[model samples]
Target: GFQFQMGDGGAFEMMGGGPRRKKPKFPKGVPKDIAKSMNWLKGTEWNWNSWRNVKFDKDGTFDAPTHDCQGGFCRWSASPEGKVYILWGDAGLHELQVQGAMPKEQDQAKMQGLRMKGRRTSDGERCQATFQRVFDFEAAELERDLYGILGLPDDAEEADIKKVYRKLSIKYHPDKNP
Candidate 1:
């Protein structure tokens, strides 16, 4: 029998082992800063753009889907100019997505306003890295309120929704009203 002792005062006995390895010990107490950070991380959200996007309340908590999305809470935005990023935040921003006609793939790269960052941090370094865009909606801010704002039901049909949208658009047109 081979007996090994770990740095944290734990010992383990092994049978027929070539090299002795120490058993890992659990920390007696978590650091206060680390504990606080972990608590905040628990509130962090990673949204997956399935077909139905996530909705948030006034307090920034999850609500419900805005509309009956087809594919899932789908992610269609991108940065070809290599500007958009997935950053680690010390204090995050209120991110939101706007629905519009998607630009051509080349034009998407020039859409520089789509940049995203983790919450602001004064003490940390700004580390940048490039990643192939997959389903990285962790920082996505989706707008799930268009249907609600229009006073339409969540299951409103496309034709009905479009008609309402046009009516509202014309009513709110600055050039026409002014």
Candidate 2:
């Protein structure tokens, strides 16, 4: 017969010597930052709602949610005790454990700069120049293709490029050409 215990210790024993603890499983759509914080909060009182309130205020304060809320979550601020906190429902408060500052890598910085420049430049000539500069910057990053060296489209796939290279190689072979 199966045994069933009945006290606090019994509950642990019934569930194989401890509380029935399963790993926390966040939804697929949860952002990495929120997920990170939530994972850290597992076993504590905090839950998904706590993750939702987290924000990374660039200026050390919370940004308005109505604005361009990048990273798919409202920004947050750090309390005097150095813990991350968010204001909820106009008056409610929630403490969040953010992993790090808002992600502002080099690429993000470039895009931010470009957006600021775009906002400032209203003249058609300036806009055209800006677009051209952006195009040149992006194009410079691409590897020059071997086909492009032979005046073929860079989009030519490996097989096509190889085929063209073989044809050219055979045509230029000295024994066959002379």
Instruction: Specify the highest-TM-score model's number.
Output: 1
Which candidate comes out best when scored by lDDT? 2
In model 2, residue pairs whose N, Cα or C atoms come closer than 3 Å (at least 3 residues apart or on different chains), thus clashing, are 55-75, 55-76, 56-75, 56-76
lDDT of each: 0.33, 0.34
lDDT of 2 by residue, 1-178 (tens): 9999767765556676555333222223322232222221111111232222222322323333443333333333332222444432333244433333432221323332121011111222211011011212222223234465777796877888788889889999999989
Give the lowest summed-lDDT range of ten residues in model 1: 30-39
User: Which residue ranges in model 1 land beyond 4 Å of their true spot?
Assistant: 1-144
Question: Candidate 2 lDDT (Cα, whole model)?
Answer: 0.34
TM-score of each: 0.24, 0.19
Clash number by candidate, in order? 14, 4
